[model samples]
Target: MKKTLIVVCTLFTFGATAGTEDSGNELSYEHFVHSDKPIKCLYGYAAEKVGDHDAAIAIFEDCIARWESVYAMIWLAQIYDTGIGVPQNLEKAAALLKRGAHTQDEAGYSSLAKYHYGILLLEGRGVPVNKQAGIEWLQRAADEGVDEAKDYLQSMP
Candidate 1:
């Protein structure tokens, strides 16, 4: 019994150390993008899934800088809106979403923009309170296939 216990503890300690070492070698978002194009999106999304918001945001920012795609803006807006990897700054999030909205054909910010903007309007966080304008933007997003906008419109009365 004593030998069995010692072996178990030794294996556990080794596994823990290995896990720590692996984590220390984890890549940042910026690195992920330049490291492998084929896996950038997947790696970024996976990092976010693991709660490394800063890394994910950095990766997305790099992607946006390089590609100028709305997808990166949308993700960045999400991070800012939720305060995932940084402080929650609705104004910055709104601005990014707006920029993305302009660049994207019709599906730029989607539900994220509408939902967060709607919440901001309700709370008057970043922009002035303009329920009407908020509703209009939300409707646009919904029409563009933002599911949250559809629900928002329904609740707007």
Candidate 2:
């Protein structure tokens, strides 16, 4: 009886500890708040990962308002496009992506934004179908070394 109890306790302890162990990729809210890294963007991502789209939206909006953060704009555009926790607004998504694509930055947000915008333009998912503009945007993304854009352009007939 005692042996079984000990084994059960040990299993419980191990399970609990395993559950608490960090996955290494998760960004905690405390870290976002305390670290020097941009809090709005990090916190927004964290919130979005946890299925808190409302909080993510607010946080991303705050980031955009403060710094025109491309990450925030892209996330917001995705959320709007997907209608996650909000009404679907393709026009809004297209506008946000366009703004992000136009914003100058060294962190490659412009490339990412252009890639997504190009896809939307190509597929007519959010914006009107404009194959020429889409190809141009994809070419720009390819020039910026976006591998997906390169692959997509090559795959085109």
Candidate 3:
């Protein structure tokens, strides 16, 4: 753990959420908490941004359970992958990416998880080295217009 953070404080921060929605930022208070006071995926980001990875993990798990938010899954995967304030768990991270891979958000955007999962599959990190499957995923990501995926595919021999 990076620092000891009170769970209550984290709960309060999530509950309060702090302001109106900004049009440009997806990570906004309004996105996390509405007048109905439902906890959304962005609540995890809020907690994480405030340096409470534990709280963020809890919130992301809850979001995944309650709403099946792909965004939450992806963010949580990143957290697990990077080991921010926690031990790196590539298996868990890869699992999250796989779970989120087929989901598209409101904007019809996806492929982010596919690319990461593809790389992990290729590296045999947390998963088996399934080169064919990895290449397929990379292809899917490239088809979806992920430049990084396209570049990766092109760079390969």
Candidate 4:
């Protein structure tokens, strides 16, 4: 019984210490995005998932510079909006989202940017509050099969 108690206490101490250590460094983006893989943005996603927001921001910025990736713009906008590893800059976030929305519309991709941008506009998060413009943007996103935008529009009497 004494041996069992010692072992349990040791295990508990180790577990608590390990939990306090920064484990984010253990998760490498290289593990997720291989050089041979066509999708390089996965590295940014992996970095963000591992709580390495600075790395994620750099990776996303690189991807955007190289490919003008609309998804990267949206992700970067979110980072700026939430102040994740950086100061909160709503205007920058709004600009990034606007660029993403335009790129998505031009590329005929999903309307995720539109949905986010519409919400920002509606709430005056980073721009002038314009319900009409916000509704129009949301309507466009809804037409493109964004269920959240559809639901939001429905909720608005």
Candidate 4: segments with Cα more than 4 A from true spot: 1-27, 30-38, 105-110
Task: Give one digit per residue, the lDDT tens place, for model 4 in 8-29.
Answer: 4553454322222233432455
**Model 2, which residues run further than 4 Å from truth?**
1-37
Ranking by TM-score: 2, 4, 3, 1
Q: Comparing candidate 2 with candidate 4, which one achieves the higher TM-score?
A: 2
Cα TM-score per model: 0.65, 0.76, 0.72, 0.74
Ten residues in a row with the worst lDDT in model 4? 15-24
Q: How accurate is candidate 4 locally (lDDT)?
A: 0.72
Top candidate on TM-score is 2
- Which scores better on lDDT, 1 or 3? 3
Model 2: worst 10 consecutive residues (lDDT sum): 16-25
Local distance difference test, candidate 1: 0.61
In candidate 2, what are the lDDT values of residues 1-157, reduced to their tens digit? 2432454455345432222233333344322322224543655665676687776787788778877889789888989999988999999999999999899776678888999999999999878999999999999999998899999999999
The Cα RMSD in angstroms, rounded to one decimal, for candidate 2 relative to the true structure is 11.7
RMSD of each: 11.4, 11.7, 8.8, 11.9
1-157: candidate 1 lDDT, tens digit per residue: 2432454455345432221222344444344645434335334554575687767776677767776646567667767878877899878877777666556434344445555566666657667788877777777777776777788678765
Kindly give the stretch of ten consecutive residues in candidate 1 with the minimal lDDT sum: 15-24
Model 1: which residue pairs collide? none
Q: Give each model's clash number.
A: 0, 0, 0, 0
Q: Write the per-residue lDDT of candidate 3 for residues 39-118, one digit (tens) a residue.
A: 44556776687787776787687777777777778888989899996799999999999888777766323577788888
Number of residue pairs clashing in candidate 3, backbone atoms closer than 3 angstroms, sequence gap of 3 or more or interchain? 0
Model 3, 8: alpha-carbon shift in Å? 23
